[model samples]
Target: MKTIKVSVVTPDGPVYESDVEMISTKAQSGELGILPGHIPMVAPLQIGSVRLKNGGNTEFVAVTGGLLEVRPDQVTILAQAAETAEHIDLERALKAKERAEHRLNEVKQSNVDFKRAELALKRAINRINVQKRDF
Candidate 1:
């Protein structure tokens, strides 16, 4: 089978680098699935799980917003934050979600940072969802 090099990078470190049969991620428009020879393009990604399939195994990583760039032979994910299902901290994520909720509820000021709070909540929710999914 033809494979494409997929690299998922974050501020902390490189999260994944592998040759995969396919990669799937959530883009701002919708869910996007890519394979070898996919059309070259770029998209802003949303907070969600990025699924990778190689051989018979599958792996997933939660990403909190990013840029996904695709070429004919490679896919590069430059994530604002990334975490694998195995590394997710459920308690911490839950706390972040709560904090974001509070921030969202208290947006009384005209210049409240909704985007930041929204991203935080989305990241926490995405991590929780990724960690709870079946392999």
Candidate 2:
């Protein structure tokens, strides 16, 4: 089977690099699935899981809003932050979720940044869902 080189990178560094038969991720526009010979293009990604399928196994990566560049033979994700399922700290994600939820509950407070808290909640939930491969 043909495969495409996929790299997931963040400001800190690369989080994942591998050859995958298929790559599936959510874009700001919608969900997208790319194959080895996919057309070259670029898209803005949402905070969600990137699924890389090779053979019978599927690996997951959580990304916090990024830009995805795809070529005929390769795919690159330039993420603000990213982590593979194995590297995601479930406990930390849970704590973050709790904190975000608490912040959201304080929406009445003028000092609370509702949008920031909502984004944090989304990111935490995304990480937890990706870690569980809930997709």
Candidate 3:
């Protein structure tokens, strides 16, 4: 089976690096999937989960937002923030989700950044969902 090197990195450091058979994630245009030997391209990634498949193993990573670069031999995700499902704190994610929900509600009655709150809610939800995946 063919594989391409995949890496996900954030300001803190590289969060994931491995050779994978395929990768799929949300792109600004829409859903994007990359395979080995794919043509070079770049797309803006949104707050969502990145799915990676390698052999029989599959993994998930939650990303706030990022840029996805697909090259002939590899794919690199320059994420603003990222976390593997194994590293995510479920309780914290739940709290964040609740906090974002509250903020969104407050926007109706007080000064609040709706867009920011929405993004936060999406990220939190993404994290929670990724963590919930059964391997």
Q: Distance from true position, residue 104, model 3, in Å?
A: 1.0
Give the top-scoring candidate (TM-score). Answer: 2
Q: What is the lDDT of residue 13 in candidate 3?
A: 100
**Candidate number with greatest lDDT:** 2
Structural similarity to truth (TM-score) of each candidate: 0.87, 0.98, 0.96
lDDT of 3 by residue, 3-119 (tens): 999999999999999999999899989988899999999999988889999888999999988899998998999999999999999999999999999999999899999999998
Give the backbone clash total of model 2: 0
Each model's lDDT comes to 0.89, 0.95, 0.93
* Model 2 spans with C-alpha error above 4 angstroms: none
Model 1, position 57, has a per-residue lDDT of: 88
Tell me the TM-score of model 2.
0.98
Q: Which residue pairs collide, candidate 2?
A: none
Prediction RMSDs, each to the true structure: 2.3, 0.7, 1.4
Model 1 lDDT per residue over 1-135, tens place: 999999999988899899999999989999999989999999999888999999998889998889999999899999988888888898988898899898988787556698888878877788888888632
Q: Model 2, 1-135: lDDT tens per residue?
A: 999999999989999999999999999999999998898999999999999999999999999998999988789999999999999999999999999999999999758999999999999999999988886
RMSD of 2: 0.7
